[model samples]
Every structure is written in C-alpha cells, then in structure tokens.
Target: MKDPKRADFRGPLVDRRALLVAGLAPLAFPGPARAEPSPAPFPFGVACGDPTSDGFVIWTRLALDPLAADGLGGLSAPTTVRWEIAADEAFRHIVLTGEATALSDNAHAVKIEVQGLAAGRPWWYRFMALGHRSAVGRAATAPDAGAATESLKLVAASCSHWETGYFSAYRHMAASDADLTLLLGDYIYEYSYVGERAAGRPRRHDRAADVVDLAGYRNRYGLYKTDPDLQALHAARPCVVTWDDHEVENDYGGLLSQDVAEDPGFPARRQAAYQAFFEHMPIRRASLSDPWRLYRRLAWGDLARIHVLDGRQYRSPAACATATSRRGSVVGDDCLERLQPERSMLGLTQEDWLYQGLGGPSARWTIIAQDLLAASIRQKGRNGVVGHWTDGWDGYPATRDRLLSAIRNSPAQNPVLLGGDIHSFWTTDLKADFADPESATVATEFVTGSITADPPPYAPFAEMLPENPHVKYFESRAHGFMSIAMTPDRMLTDYRAISDRRDPRATVSTLRTFAVESGRAGAVAA
Candidate 1:
C-alpha cells in the first residue's frame, strides 16, 4: 500500500500476506473449490472494535452472497485479505499493515487485532481481497492510562431485531461524530416471526428455524449483516460489545436454557452462537470455548473507564421456572425462588472484579457498560402491583445490593452506567434498596432503547413509575440510540430517537436529556 498507485486503488484490495493463508485453505472448511470465484467478496462489509490505548481490531468477511441459503455465504473456498490502519482517511501516514485469513471455518471472516500505536487518536482502515478493496472505516484508540482526559463522546445502542424494523438508527449513528459505540447485545434475535408479525416483517432470515445449530446461527448473523445501516455503524466507530440472551436463546441463563434446565444441546447451540458472534464482530480474542468469560475493562486515560460486563453467561437461572411451564418473566408473591440470596447475575468472580474496579477514586468517569439493566421496574394496576422482575438485576437483588454498596463505599468520583436490553429508554437513579425511598442513591443508570426493534408499550410501564420513585425518567415508545457526552465535571446523556423505523430516510431527534454531575450519584435533567 506504500505505492501511490496501489494506495489510490478504490474498492477491495487483497493483501499480499493473504496468500500465506490462502495456500492452506484446503485444511479449512468448504475445502478448496476449483470453480471460479466472484471478483468482489466483501458482501458483509467491514467493521472495527475492542479498542485499547495502543491498538484496535479490524474485521471483514468474504461473502459473495450474504443471504445465501446454505449459510456458506457463497464461499466454496478459504480466502486471503490484507488490512491497513492509517492516521488519516487519505492513507498518508500508514501506521499498521497486516494480512488475515478469511477461513470458511470462521464463515470467511477476518479479525486482526492491530497494536503498538499512539493513543487517543482517530484512525482509518480498510480490507483488500481478490484484487478488490472494501470500504474504509473509522476507529479510535483509548487514551493512555493515568493520563489526563478532558472529555469523551460515546454512542450506546442495542436490541436490533432484524425482522421487526429497519436500521435507520444505525445509519444516523454511523454518520455521527462520536468517538466510539457500545453495542449492549441482542445483536441478533433467535426467534422466528409468525402470524401478523411475520406478515409485516421488514426482513426475513435465510432459513427461519429459530437457529438451533451452527449453520442456523451463521445464517442468522449473515442475514443481519446484510443491512447497510448496521454495516455503516460497525464501520464508523470502534465499539465495546457484550452479549445478552437473545444472541443465543431467548432468556437463557448460564448453566440452563430458558425453560428446560437440562437441555443437553443447549451448550452446543450456545457455543455455536458464541463462535458465530466472534466471527462476525471485530472483537479481540473473544472466548468461544468457555462459558464464563467476556467480562473485562477498557480505560480511556484518567477521564473514563468502561467496564464491559457479561450478565448472561454467568447468571443463575430465572426464578419460578418449572417443567411443562417455564415462564420466569412475571413478578409475583408466589415465586419464592426469586428471592434466593445465592442467585447471581455477574457470578461471584466477575462481581468481585467489578467491585474492585469501582472501589477506588480513580478515573473521573467510571462508566459501567453492560447489557442488562439494574433498575427496579414494576407493573401496576388499580392496586399498584409490585412484582419482582427476575430477568434483570431485580431478579438477583442480593448481588445488585452488593454492587450498589460497593459504589457507595468506594471513593470513586462519578459512577455511571450505560445500559441497553429492555428496548426502551430509561433514566433511573440506582439505589441500594428499591423498597426504601430514603436509601442512598449510590450511582446512576442510563438505559437506551432498541436500534430497530419494536417499541415497547408505554402506559403500563408508566403506571409503575409512580411506585418506583428511584426512576427519574422512562419512555417505552421509541427506537434509536443514546449519545453520552462526558466531561470531568458532569456527564450528559441525550436520548436520540428516530422519527420512524420503517422509513429509509428517517430523521433523528433527542427525546430527552439527563445529566449526572461529578461527585453526585443520581441523574437530573440537564
């Protein structure tokens, strides 16, 4: 890429090192096809994520037809690709260059974790393969640890179920000037649409069988990757990601399936989903062989620290699940299992790690970037119902209390949480005890709605807010991402919502704005 003529080449450019992995293609899946291949294989586009102070990951997939039926992405052979990271969009100052193998075993995807560069700066990257070059993408590195950080602008998004709506939210996000994006899971849904929902489906899976196996999961991911808005979001910013239940099976816990506790195939299916997610995403060294990992931390100098927590893989099973009827969603007095003290969401080890991270007065902004929420939301009728939601932190009250106590006991300055998964915007004051209105407000939780998934009903959730005083704001009817702009003094959160999900030319506007002042725990209107 040093040559001016080669640098001027637009479209896809396969790296020279791709050939090294190319010769060994036969050892991978799909074997080596003698048949002629397509000229351009970047069907799924390019992405970058999991950034650090020194480096970040770049990703691309070789797919002739992203929605191909067999979920092979029309790849009959392994392919080679080259990647480069530049200081500018014009590729003037090339920093890192490398080759990666797009193996069929990984669904023809390539992920190269590039390192050893300056921190807190913007970078551009692209992929080349088969004489064609993929589109250019932008990513940013975290600032050096213990260094002075003035401000950070981040975009938070989640719960993008493909069939429900269009991804205009992602399009808007991709066009934004945010430094990074955080995808709070539900990246892909595992259920098939039926009845009227199927009739009005915006998109359909390649093969809609609820994704039980490897092929099914791969096809599902391929189907979602075909969206231009989603692709643009991936290309526009480096992201910190963690998974929730929808990526595997709906409402699934660590050691148990959503319903039946002893489904032997659940682990294999989950492993396939995990592998497929790792293949598609630009995450670095994500564990597919383990069940209890993916919880880690990323720092942005002394200004901010992001704790990406995985609440799905280590949590105890939902309360009140039984054979023949395993509905563990609703809260009620009948479910004694929900109040078990041993129930955990982040498991014991991860919980302790999180506590330690929040124990000290370190970064000016200690942001908890997790998938599930911690607010105590209840449903209400004329009697004002108070149900214990076992799916989120409300289900594991003991652990939630422990975390809140840690934040309160710690000398940390500004403790804030950016969360997604409920598919509705929320600005709640996180307290140690939901029952005690006078309990100290330990920290703040700002939850964003879905990118394209269906908007949740507003009225019922609205009724419950009166009883739950800790909730400062709530909106259940919207589809968009949240933008968080944080400085050392205060963090401002804007709930950016799109006008319509189906419209290709939808406009984005802020639904509300909330701010948590530095040295303060609760959030107030900005």
Candidate 2:
C-alpha cells in the first residue's frame, strides 16, 4: 500500500542502477526516514554559495510547517534528502547525485559541498525528498585559479528591513545577468513588535518579541527566507555572505552588548545567534567549527581576487562609548580616545592575516568586500561641531591607515573597495590623508545603498558634503543596489534604484554609472 502522505510528482526521475554504475551513489543515511510531503519539503527554497573552481555549496531545509513555534520546521525525526546537479536545466544529463540526512537538531537544514565538476560554467541543481521535489536553482563554479578570464558581473546589496518596506529590489536583482552576489550585512532585523503593525510598514516580523534566544533567531530567519523574491535571488546567483550588527544585535562590538554594557546573558545570546546563522546560511562547515573563520579569500581567475573581511566579531569596543551604551556614538575631534593608535576594528589577528599576503601577483583587480565604509566621512554632531561616527572605519584611524598603507605598498593592482551599512550610496576617493584635498588618492570606494532600510535625512548629509571634497557623489533618497562589472582593463558600476520600495511591483532604473580604469586611483563618470 502506498503512503497517503506521499504526493505524486511527474518530474524527471533518475535510474538508481545507472547512478551506481557511474560511481555516483548517494551517501548512506541511517535510521528510518520520516517524510513530510504535505506542506512541501522545501519551504525556504534553495541556495548555493562559496563557489570554488571545482565546486560549490548547495543548501536546502525541509520544512513541513515553516512557522511552527518550536523552530524545528515541523519536523520531529530525521529525514533523508536527495540532491542532484546537472549540466543543463533539464535533468537529461545528470552529473552528480547524493543523499543527505536532515536532522531536527539543526532545523533540518542540508548543506552539501559538491566537488569534482568543471569550472567557469553554470550548473542546475534541485532537491528531492519523499516524492516531493524542490525548485530548480542555478549555480556556477569559478574559473580555475590564475586562469585568464574576460569579465565578471557582480551584484552587491545590503540592509533589507522587512517591516519597513517590500523586497522589490531582490526581484529585480534576481533578473539581472550577474555571475555572483555579495550580501554584505543586516540580512535580518532582531527587533519584534507587538499590537497592530506600525503605519507605513509593509509587514511585521514573525516572532512576537526581540530575538535573544536560539528559537527566536531561528524563527526570524524562517520568516525572511519565506520571502519569494529573496528565495528567487538566492536561487539565481551563487552568493558570498557576511553579517553586520543586526545578525546578532544592534551595534554589538566584540563581547559587549549595545543596550546594556554588562548584560550577563550576552555571551549565550551571541552563541545562539551564531549557531542559528550558520544553520540557515549556505556557508561551509569550517565556519561552524571556527566561529571567527568568516574572513577568507576567493579567486575568480586572473581578473580579480575577492578578499572578504569580518569586522564585527573580534573588534575593540567603540571609542568614546559610555558605560551604559557600548557600541557606537558620535565623538568630536576633541575625544582623545577616538584617535588612539591601539584601538583596532578587525582585531589584531585578522589585521595581521589581511596584511600578510595583501594582494597576490596573479589577479589584475583586487576587490575588498567588507561590512562598513572604509573612507572617512565627517558630519555635524551638535553645536556646529564636526564629528565622526564611531561604528565604521573612521573610529579606528590607525587600523585604517595600516590597511591603506598595505594596499599602497603591495603588488595589488587596481584595488576597489565595496561596502554597505550606512543606508546611503556614496562614491568617494580613498585618500592617504582626508584632511588635505591635495593628498594622494590610494583607491576608489563604492558604497551600496540599503535595499529597504530608511536612510538618514539628506539635507544634513548634503550640507556637509562641501567639507568632504573627496566625496565624488552622495545620494540618500534612493533605495537600491550596485551592479558591478569588471574586466582586465576597467571596472564599471551602475547604481540601480527602484521607483518605490513600498510597491511590490516596482520598476528599476539606473541612477548613475561610474568607471575605474586600470591603474587609476579614483572613479569618474562613465
């Protein structure tokens, strides 16, 4: 007798004997598998990340009921999930097939690091479990290390607050012709509201209270993953992800909490947040074992070398912070602690690792992917005094100087910095000395605007622009992302903005375009 819970799927099927003959046997999973075929097995959809020349990591979570209060995705026992990767969209040519166990402990999430595949091309993938199949996703492997390549297209986005507006930018990003995506930070917010939803807010978070425990964080991620546009964007392009403050808590630094300086439960809360983040994200197993291993490097042939940095975990506390509020604060030039040389943002260890190789000799373009803006920005604090925000690179001047010196002294060519987290778009010239306009420009920095988060008031931000001559362009009224394309000769970037973030069916347009030529230090209008 057939199991009534299992539904019939007429999709393509692979022969078990043929797979064994090709030495592509599925991995052995123990225990009797409990099937959840009713509410669809893959409710959160599919995602792939951390692409290498040979393979990439593909992920999916089996959710019978995604919004269950237990944060287990309505699963009580272990289940076996089968995955396949094909060279074409149709399943006619299967390259690899494998099976994995989805245990309830980790929310039934499966992350498989596929290997031994061809490089520099796209591959189609899908997941199967108990007569149900997931949506087909597209992923590609990077070109061989040091291999000559022509061009690479990348999309950079950040700060999508679900309660504020719709994720229409992700829908447009999914339709873009890009090879890779970088989700810089603030993927999910930690705040949870009560009573009726706020005015001008499109939606509310899933959990009823703030996320301080493991279950709360898990449910929050579940809610964000349910967004169809976000799922589509993940399925379309292989992503490289890193987190900012909201992934754990707002403006948290090192082992200190932002709200209360000496919160006793902060360590456990941070651990739970890290565990939930690893379980949901498509990162490798190395990140799970070593929590601080988020900083790494990836090579896309000889064209570019992407150096991803983690600036949150091991940093010194913000300078000039009060005893009660330990994260970030605006401090004027008179604050002596803000200019101390001992304060570091990336920690001494990561700073050493980042400065070691600097940039290799192979890649023509060196790309620095990080959380916050690296360039210095001065804004009016109070009483007409000029101050710097301590949450970003400006707070750690010594570390920033060391980083800039490393880039200037290394063999790295045509270095470009990509950043987010200010909720505004900025194109600035990274100078050796921001105090002097005639100082040498070291590199060009492009800061992507938020996807849905509210921006700071533009009038004040614009009023201080004259004080910052290195700032080529600054716009705070738009909500969009940056589309970057790079070749051996030059890199072109387009600031793509949406008409309205409140409307789900918003239209997208290019607000501006800029280019950085080979061996150039600043960006120019393209």
Candidate 3:
C-alpha cells in the first residue's frame, strides 16, 4: 500500500520532449504485446477530470465498436490496460505508471486516479490497452491550500443535445486556452432522434430509442462520445461534470420523472442510468456509489472554491405538479404550493453542506457550479403581478431564501453562481426578496446557454426582462459557452456564440463581456 503521507513520486527521469529537443537517447516505452493493438479499442478517446492538489483521474473505455447494440463496447472479457502520467508533454520523464483492468462489467472502461505528484503544475497522460496507444491529454494539480495566484481560467458550458445541431460550439471550446472545462449538464440526451425534418432538426441517432435500461443509457453515452468535436474537448482539458435531467429522462427529479407520472419502475431505470453515468464520466468512485448525492466542493488554492450541485437528483417535485397539468411550464399565484418551506431544490443534506461551504472563508472567489438557474426569473406579469415557470429556483422560493440568507450571513467572499440548463445566457443579481424591489443583493449569477441545443423562444423572454429588474443581461440567440477568468478582485465572463450552429465550419465569436468586481454584487460592462 502507498503511504498516504508521501509528498510526491518525482525521480531522476528524462522528459518526453527532451529526447528530440536535446538529441538525447530516446526513452523506450513498454515493449510490444503478443499482438499489436489497433486504435479501434480506444474509440471514445481519452479524458481527464476531477483534478486535485496532488492528482486527477484519467479515463478511457476499450471499445471495438462504440455503437454496439449491447453497449458493451465489444469487450466480452476482462482486459489489462496500461496507464502513465508524465511531467511533460513527452513521456520521457515518467512519474507514475501501472496496470489496471478494464472489466466487462464496467463497460470495459478504465479510470486511474494518479496521485503523489507536484502541486499546481500541468501534467500529460495517455493510455495503452490491447497493444494500442491512446491520445495524450492534459490535466493539472490544484495549487496547494492557501496558495495564491493572480489569475485562474476555467470554461463553463452545458446542454449539448446531439440532434439539435452540429457540435461546432464544442469544437470552438476545445481550442480555448483554459485550465479546466465544466460540463454543467445534459451531457447526453436520453430521448431518441425521430422528429420531422420540417422541424429544422439537424441530426438523428444512429441506432437507438429513448434510453431506459443500463444498456440503453450506455449506448446513448457512447453515441454522443463518438462525435469528434465532443471527443476533442474531453481530450483537451480535464472536465468537471454534473448531470441534469435528459441524462436519465426529461425533468426527472429523484424517483419522479418529468413529462410523465412516477412509475413503479422509475427507481430501476434511475439506477441503470446512474451506473452508465459513472461508467462514462471521469468522476471518482465515491460519486458513482450514490448518484443522488453528487454535491461536492473543490478548491483552487486560495483563488477560488467550486461547489457543484446535483439539482435534479434529490429536488422535490416541481411546485405546480398537478394531477391534470403534470408540469408547471408557467404560472402565478395559482401555484400556491410553491410557497412551502420544505419544498427543496438541493434537499436537506446538500443544503447543509452548501451552507457550510458558504459560511467559511477559504478562497477569494466563492463559486457554485450548479445545473440550473437560481434567480427569480418570471414571465406573464402585469400590474405588479408576476408568475414563474416552476422548474428553476423560482419554484422553491423558501429554498432560495435559505441559500441567499446563508450567503448574506457567511464569511464567503465574492459569492457567484455559475449555472446552466436555461438554454440562454442570463446575468442576474440574487436578491434577498424578489417581491421587494429594494432587496439587497446577496450574490451574483451568470447562466450560460446551450452549446448546440435549441433555446427557448426569445419574444417572451424579451418581454419578461423589462418586468424583472434583477436580470441584468439576457440573450437567447446565441449557441455557445462562457469563458471566465478569475482573479483576487474581479471575474471577467465572455458570452461567446457561433454564427451558424448548423454549419460544421462555423466560427465562434464573443457576443458580450461582463465583469464582477470584488465587493460589488452584480456584473457590469467590462
């Protein structure tokens, strides 16, 4: 067993690039296997994620055919896979390497968490399985606790529905020079592609219906991973992921599914989707054991702290879920059930955990990387009366209050919410009371738009923003992601969009920019 107290495993080693650059002896890799492995085995490519001060997780699945009917990736038996982490882009200076099993039960997937490395430095890694070599990927260890830095860059994105359009947005995100990528949710849509061409849909599923069982969910994930653009992003940077609905089913909340009534078999389906999520993601084993409790915190030295929340897993049913109406797409005082204090979006355990993180002082920037909007976004208002769509934090009024109150009373600095799932960009101030126009700002929020998925109709939102003063910036025509830069005193966000999500050759451009200065409550033009 490794001693838990070991600092690092550095040793006298040659850098991978040094051999070519310095004209030194070439470092030998593992000798050839009995049979040369083909690139087909690593079809989904390699990914790195969940980075920490000492280490991060590297992931890849051995797949002969990614879209196999069984979603098994064509591996029927256990296979041995080799992994290595190097200090530089070249593998000459190897730090950690070992053998791991890619088991059939685990979808022939391999996730190796490499540790005992130098902190706050970039590292490169690759995989070898079945005699084939995987592509190189980059990841980094977080700065040591209390470590200070002038700037840290991370990209925020979400909602990539395959059939909506080409993933040109993701292609652009892969080129960005950032430290980490955050895939907020809707990593893969559960529904199959079978709509009218007249509807303006861009693509269709290869061979699948709506995902239900483990095989279905696994296949869906595999199909989405097959996209070259999506694969490139996963390979470029370590992604931090959290799922919203659609990963399982539309509007699913714990045991209850959206657009449908709770069924006796919903729990079984949830378990299946939960397992597939683990098999594909670079998440640690602890997260896989309980999908309902994925809320966790990560710190980037003293620069920033990230708290990612699983909003759909344990949230109470939508506020206006009625026998006939089923879902509350839009409503007003008629949805009185929304006023209950016990109606929670984060549930009890996650709520307490988040409150504790907010109440502490550890980082200069306190960020909540969540799966849905938290502001009081409402529509259909007239004569000082307004209504809300009961899917977001607006439905859980009391829940929102508790969270905002915690921020108000906490020692947390520059609390900002980074959110997705709305399919539009929104910059809003989290207020203590939405009804009271003079309410104090407790936090700031920046909501990113869907990468390629269709956004909501713009006219209604355009009409609604005038009634909602807290919403500082709103745009629905964009199909792209947010690039954010953080410092001790300010955060700069770029709302990027592509001209044509339908065109594979589309170019990405910034639509607008906003800056949140430390001690200021809302974003301002930068």
Most accurate candidate by TM-score: 2
Once fitted onto the true fold, the runs of candidate 2 whose alpha carbons sit more than 4 angstroms away are: 1-39, 193-197, 287-289, 359-361, 382-385
Candidate 1 per-residue lDDT over residues 341-416, each given as its tens digit:
8888889988988888887547898889888778877764335546866778878878888888888788676888
Give the TM-score ranking, best first.
2, 3, 1
lDDT of 3 at 337: 88
lDDT of 3 at 55: 76
Clash pairs (backbone) in predicted model 2: none
RMSD of each: 6.0, 6.3, 6.2
Superior candidate under lDDT, 1 versus 3? 3
List where candidate 3 sits over 4 angstroms from the true fold.
Answer: 1-38, 197-200, 259-262, 287-292, 381-386
What is the clash count of model 2? 0
Report the Cα lDDT for candidate 1: 0.79
How do all models score by TM-score? Answer: 0.89, 0.92, 0.91
Specify the highest-lDDT model's number.
2
**Cα lDDT, model 1, residue 26:** 14
Task: Name the 10 consecutive residues with the lowest summed lDDT in model 1.
Answer: 24-33
- Model 3 TM-score? 0.91
- Listed per model in order, the count of residue pairs whose N, CA or C atoms clash below 3 Å is 11, 0, 4
